[model samples]
Target: MADEKPDFEVPVGLFEDFEDLKAQVARLTAQLQTLTEGAGEEADEASADDVTAGAEEADRGDAPEDEWQYPPFILLLDPPQYDDELRALTEWVEGVLVPGYLAEPSSDARWCHLWFEHPVAVARLHALWLAWQELTDPASCGYTGPSVWHRDHLDPSMRELRGSSGPFAGCTKGEHQIDHRIPGLVPSAWRQNDA
Candidate 1:
């Protein structure tokens, strides 16, 4: 067969139909909300549903139990940018969060005791954990939110930080990775320096 490009199709004129697109999106959103609300049995059962909605509302007040609420993240850091902030954040993550989480009975097997060595890995993993918390907040996060979080954030970060081709690839020694140390405790790396 002669070389040929496959036929492609798109709306004939989208620029002229901005209002139409907005209307369509509004309709779809309403439909999605309707489907998401389902038979209204949950509304009947949930007293708190009358008060607030979605992630923003969840930030306002305590949500009722029996919803998909996730506890506040215990390991949150400041928007760590400067050297001081980074040092503090790294300290908290490695010295506090990692050790504390590992001690917890609920800590996941996949992450347990996996020393995240690289600074980027530390920051990225912390960010992912924070996103997971936000995505699992039942009051604001939709039913599929956690699934989205898993697909979009957890899967990719885990792969990059722990995958065979990624940061922790050669770092593991059996169940343990020897390449990492608690960041705050690494005197060699963090020794006080005069600029």
Candidate 2:
């Protein structure tokens, strides 16, 4: 008998709860790390007000010039940043997007397990994730944010990402195209002139 994948049904709301818990845990961990580091510093150098202000700034999602910026475009990031962002993107795609939205794939609708290897797919999915983060944040977008996200971002992104002529075109539901190649662009006129 062929091995079949187990089908475990997950409640839709559970993903959201999990995400919230993760965010909370991350925030607490960061705070703990900051406090621990501060403890090591000369006590007089780090004032209570300074710590409080830094915490408040973090709570407000404010960052100094050197801090990591959000909604980073995958293609534009440096290698280390790209790897970190790609890992997070993969988690979001596999853990949340696919589980919640992607339907059983067909000839018309497709998905590639190696989507991250496809540059176009990576760019598109990164954009979608960036929008998701912005729209889903209660501080940035209020109660109606999720609705706006679905209407303005999710629908179009998903359609394009899974469309028959999209990045995963040659891939199928049951199999990934190992030799999938991105179509080449026209040779640069400048390079031709140089030649």
Candidate 3:
């Protein structure tokens, strides 16, 4: 009533002795491990029990025939930064591994496609593709978009070049500053220069 907190009796520390505390903890830990091991063993036993049923089902021809589906396009592009590399990797898979997998029809071969999730692996393949492309064409400069090599990202460069500077810069306002292209690369702003 007077705006003061009420007092209550405090409880004593639960474990009075270190050895007892350690023994209790050890017991709890052992109990937990035993429970977990039991659960795991039961699960394993259940799985083992399922084997006969699985074999019977397989015998009945309920198992699917071997057929490979093309990997999902979006999953292939999971690492957008490695798009160039992924393209080459997928090409190699389609060319070399896929044919072998199809010919062999083995479960292990199916996993080769799954192993391609690593971006670095895809990038390595992409590097190979670039090397091949350069060797074959001798002048294929690839998508040299502003994003790939410009000062700011691509959208800004496109916006600036299109005569709309920033959100505030108006057509009649600031004197248009002709933004340079990526360093060391010449940009053809004028139509005739593009040729």
Give per-residue CA lDDT, model 3, range 37-125, as digits (tens). Answer: 76776545577568888789779857544422333333334466346546656776678535642343222221223334433334333
Candidate 3: which pairs clash?
A: none
C-alpha lDDT of all candidate models, in order? 0.55, 0.82, 0.42
Q: Report residue 121 deviation for candidate 1 (angstroms).
A: 1.6
Better of 1 and 3 by TM-score: 1
User: How many Å off is the CA of 8 in candidate 1?
Assistant: 36
Candidate 2 residue 48 C-alpha distance from true site, Å: 28
The collision pairs in model 2 are none
TM-score of predicted structure 1:
0.35
Q: Model 3, poorest ten-residue lDDT window?
A: 165-174
Q: Pick the candidate with the highest TM-score.
A: 2
**Residue 80, model 3, lDDT:** 63
Error of 1 at 127 (Å): 1.4
Write the candidate numbers in order of decreasing TM-score.
2, 1, 3
The digit string of per-residue lDDT tens for model 1 on 1-195 reads 478878987664554255445655775787788667776566567555554365555787655564446433323333433445455545766775567543322212234344444555666766776676666764345445577787998677765655555545445344545454346654554345567
